[model samples]
Structure formats: structure tokens, C-alpha cells
Target: MARCETCGNDYDRTFEVHMEGKTHTFDSFECAIYELAPRCAHCSVPIVGHGVQKDDVLFCCNHCATAVGVHELRDRA
Candidate 1:
């Protein structure tokens, strides 16, 4: 059994996620996402998909990017 890093749960089915040369153990996907997902620069929501990036900042959508003064990003063609 392994211990979850997020909620401190110990379970036999715990899994490991590797990111940026680091390893994270979690009992469920929810905890993993909560710990690993990048937050939007504007609304502070977890980015689960291919989010927009302006310079070094990450935004969950074009609207969020625009809210933070990133006007060149578009959600659709």
C-alpha cells in the first residue's frame, strides 16, 4: 500500500504521476488533478485541457487570457 500525497490516504490502488522529474502519488484521479493541474491566471480554475498561454502565464480559455490583457488569443477561427 502507498500513501496519497494530497489527502494523506493510504490505499493499495494508489498510483503515481510523474511531472517535471518529480513523482506524485494519489489515491484517486481527483486528488491528482487537484494537486498537479495548472491554475488559470485570471479565474484561478484548474486547467484540465489544452489551455491558452500568453508569455509565461497560463489561462484556461481565451476569455480569461483577454481578461488579463492578452488580446491576441482567440477561441475559434
Candidate 2:
């Protein structure tokens, strides 16, 4: 099983996506989209490189995640 680096979710399949002429693997469809979406803290352009996670906060990237400031919006337990 592969675990999402950002959300820490386990998944069965790993998707290979091309970005900036480089290929990256994601754990799920939603995770791939989150990485590709063009909404960041610094700009509206799509984010590249590794996803960002801080404490209980999650961001598409470090900049946006830091900018938007994520909170514990859900409780699994």
C-alpha cells in the first residue's frame, strides 16, 4: 500500500502524473487534483514539487497551505 505524503491516507494504486516534464506519483485521484490545482498562497498558478502539511493543517503546497492556514475542520473519531 502507498500512503499519501500530504494527507497520510493509504491507497491501493499509485498514479503517475506529468508536471513540468517530470513524473510524480499520487495516492489517489483527489490527491492528484489537489497537487495540480492552480491556487496557491503566493500566486494563482499551479503548484509543483512536494505537498505541504503542518500540524493539523494541509495545503496544496507549503505556500498556500501556510497562507490559507488550515484548521481541524473534521474529526474522524
Candidate 3:
């Protein structure tokens, strides 16, 4: 059994996620997301999908990017 890195739970069915040259063990997907997902620059929410990015900044959506004076982003095509 491996211990979850996020919740510190020792479980039997834990899984490992490799990202950016690091390995993380989690008991559930929720824990993995909480620990590994990138946060939006404007709202500070974890971006779980194909989020918007401009240079070194990240945003959950185009609206948030635009709200922060990033005018060229769009929500969709």
C-alpha cells in the first residue's frame, strides 16, 4: 500500500501520477487534481481542462484572461 501525498492516507489501491519529473501517489482522482492541477492566474481556481495560457500566466477561461487585460483571448472558435 502507498500513502497518498495530498491527504496523507495510507491506502491499498493508490495510484501514481508523473508530471514535470515528479511522481505523486493519490488514493483518488480528487486528491491528484488537488495537488497537481495548475491554478488560474486571475481566479486562483485549479484548471482541470484545456485552460488558456499567455506567456507565463495561466487562466481558467478566456473571460478570466480578458478580465485581467488580456484582450486577444477567446472562449471558443
Q: Evaluated with TM-score, which candidate comes out highest?
A: 3
lDDT string for model 1 (19-48, tens) is 999999999999998999999999999999
Query: What TM-score against the true fold does each predicted structure earn?
Result: 0.91, 0.39, 0.92
Candidate 1 matches the true fold with a TM-score of 0.91
User: Which rank order by lDDT, best down to worst?
Assistant: 3, 1, 2
The global C-alpha lDDT for each of the candidates, from Candidate 1 onward, is: 0.93, 0.59, 0.94
Better of 2 and 3 by TM-score: 3
- Pairwise TM-score winner, candidates 1 and 3: 3
Candidate 3 regions exceeding 4 Å error are none
**In terms of lDDT, which candidate is stronger, 1 or 2?**
1
Evaluate candidate 1 by giving its C-alpha RMSD to the native, one decimal: 1.0
Candidate 3 lDDT, tens digit per residue, 1-77?
99999999999999999999988899999999889999999999999999999999999999999999998877788
In the range 1-77, model 2's lDDT, one tens digit per residue, is 77675477777876678889977678877777677665444455544544455554344554455456554322222
